[model samples]
Target: MFLIRTLHKWFGLVLGVQFLLWALSGAVMALLDHHKVSGEHALLPVAGLQAPAELLPLARVAQAIGQPIQKLQLKPLHDTYVYEATTPQGVKILDAVTGAPMAIDAAKARELAVGRWSGSEPPASVSYISRHTLETRDLPLPIWRVEFADKERHALLVSATTGEVMAAKNDTWRLWDIAWMLHIMDYDDRQSFNHPLIITLGTGAAWLALSGLILLFRSFRRSDVAWVLDGAEALRRRGR
Candidate 1:
């Protein structure tokens, strides 16, 4: 009993701050608007665009790829139709109309970002980030980041490899990220929540709760509730 109380006190001291952080972070996250955190709203409407009535033959697409095609997708890249082919050399985007090979250069990345953006504000800046950032955390590397001058600080991440607008970011997402970092106890990349430090903290927290419950049950004695028991016996005799 003494040891359990001592351990509970120590664990409470160690995990007290973390517990508070978890509570505060959880509250903040719940308050945040999920729709604003993600950038699906920035996507341009594809209602008018329709699939091509006639697609180029697979042989033609394979020939333009110049490699053994492992997989292929016939999708619309904005208004233009293209075939995204996966090969040993990686994904190759070829024009479905002419079967010409296409490359997603820095210029093209910016162009695609603009095409996907639904805002009236022009692009403030475009930079190719080959490394990870808070906005591009856990996403595939080498994305083109496009920032807009809107009041929300709307930002877009376009895949440098595939020319696809992978993610959208804004001030709301930035604000929520801080809470997520604290909630997950992931200070570095803020990508994973299942690390050792968090696990240990979680275990310690659980132990604190369970120990408290055990101590509570053990702390009570029959004498403490004897009066209530006696009153109940008197009531039964009176009923008889």
Candidate 2:
């Protein structure tokens, strides 16, 4: 126990800076909007809808997007249905009723699109455009907007009228944005997890905590013994 406590204290002292950085970074990540890191648009919810149709068919909605919906949640917005969902390619917002895009516009689309091409040259060259991709059909309109943090500089706008993808941006994610992502993705076993730094930091923190607990127990015992001994000595001195 005593050994553990000593080890814990020393571990904390050694790794204190790392923990602090992680903490600060985590806090920033939780609060900072990834889309706004570059000092651009605000991340807003997809808006312009009222409420989702209670009896609507999920299959019909999936067909509207040409893919299976991973998850779908609906909320009420001004007598319309606003839906949030995820797909294999990305996260999305949708309109529960007609599925028309309502939430976003060209400006918001630019913000999401810019992040994806942050490191790339300005004037992104389209490597290829899939002709097979269908034009916007049954998807709802954007009722609100949201900034995503999956990648640098890229954000998505979900529609509020009919659940549809409105616009996206590609650009560079700020330094703080990357830092925040790393902080959240902490794991163990770098080769397996693919993020050695976060794993290393987490492991270091665990070690520090273990050492601290051991030290605390030892200190309590030592203090109790010392107090008893001091009391005995005072009694003896008075007797003498």
Candidate 3:
């Protein structure tokens, strides 16, 4: 019994901090509005606009890029109508009216991000990101990160190819992310919870629960059962 109790005490000490963090993180996530955390409120939706009266032909686009086109789309990149061409090399954008090739550079990325921003302030900073990160996880690489000069530090991610606002994030989301990291027990990537540390800790927690349940039963003494035993004897006497 003493051995079991000692083990239980040590386990509680080890897991207590993690349990408290779980509770706190859960509370924060619950209190936060889903819309704000997702940055949906910071970015505007793409509204449909009227297209140009005349568009350049597909032959002109082929001649300009000199690549075999797998697929093509005529769509609005903000106000400018452009043809998105999927070539063997990669995606190529060309002005639909003039058939001139268009590149999605840092300047163009800023335009796309700012155009989608719903806030009053223009972007505080804009940078081209070609690698994956905690902010850009699961999203396609080679994107543009646009940050706004606001209290929330509202940021927007724009696609390098299509000039679309792929994702939005803010200070609220960053705070919630810390809570999530603690809750999931994934301190590094904060993306996946199915790692070895969590699995080991989960196993320990399960053992603590099972051992605590056993201790519950073993904690009771013979005196605690005396009343029930006496009552049964009284019933037997009455029967006799």
Candidate 4:
């Protein structure tokens, strides 16, 4: 019992701050609207596309690019048609009509953002990012960050290479993300929820709870309150 109590005390001291952080972060996450945090409210509706009369043959595109095309997709960015090819080497975007390699420039990225934006106002700014950051750690590098001047101040992340809208973020989403980082105890990358430190702390917390229960039961059995109750019952029985 002494050993268990000591262990519990030390573990509690070590994990108390983490426990508070988890609780606080969990509460904040639960209170915030999930849709807004996920940027669903800022998503633009997909427009219907008319089928083209003719398309460049996959074999010809493969021969020209000198790579085997594993998959192909026809994607429309703004008013232009682009063919996205997934190959063993990497992903490549080409002009759908002319079969020429197409690179997404800042102007094209801004145009794509405007087309996908759900807000009425145009984008406030568009900037190209060549490096990864905490918020965009999961996405591929060299992305376009498109910011809007809407009520939520939403920002859209567009892939410079794939020409795809990768993610959306607002102030609410940023707060939620920070809370999630705290709740998971992942401070470095803020992406992993099941790191070794968290696993160890979780195991310690469980052990502490079980040990506390055992201590409570032992104290109840050993206390004078139990003997007093027994004595009162014996007297009642003798009177009866």
Q: What is the C-alpha lDDT of each candidate?
A: 0.87, 0.51, 0.88, 0.85
Query: What's the number of clashes in each of the models?
Result: 0, 63, 0, 0
Scored by lDDT, the top model is 3
| Model 4: CA > 4 A from native | 1-3, 54-68, 221-240
TM-score of each: 0.87, 0.34, 0.91, 0.82
- Tens-place lDDT per residue, model 1, 4-40, is 9999999999899998999999998999998888767
User: Model 1, residue 87: displacement in angstroms?
Assistant: 1.0
Clash pairs (backbone) in predicted model 3: none
Model 2 scores what on Cα lDDT? 0.51
Cα TM-score of candidate 2: 0.34
Q: Model 4 over residues 1-240: C-alpha lDDT tens digits?
A: 899889888888988888899999999999999999989878777677775678778777776567887888888766767788898878899878778898888887888888888889888988889988866888998899999998788989989888888888899998998998899989888888789988998998999899888888777753558689889989999999
Q: Regarding lDDT, does 1 or 2 come out ahead?
A: 1
RMSD of each: 2.4, 11.4, 2.2, 3.2
Cα distance off (Å), candidate 3, residue 186: 1.4
**Alpha carbon lDDT of residue 78, candidate 3?**
81
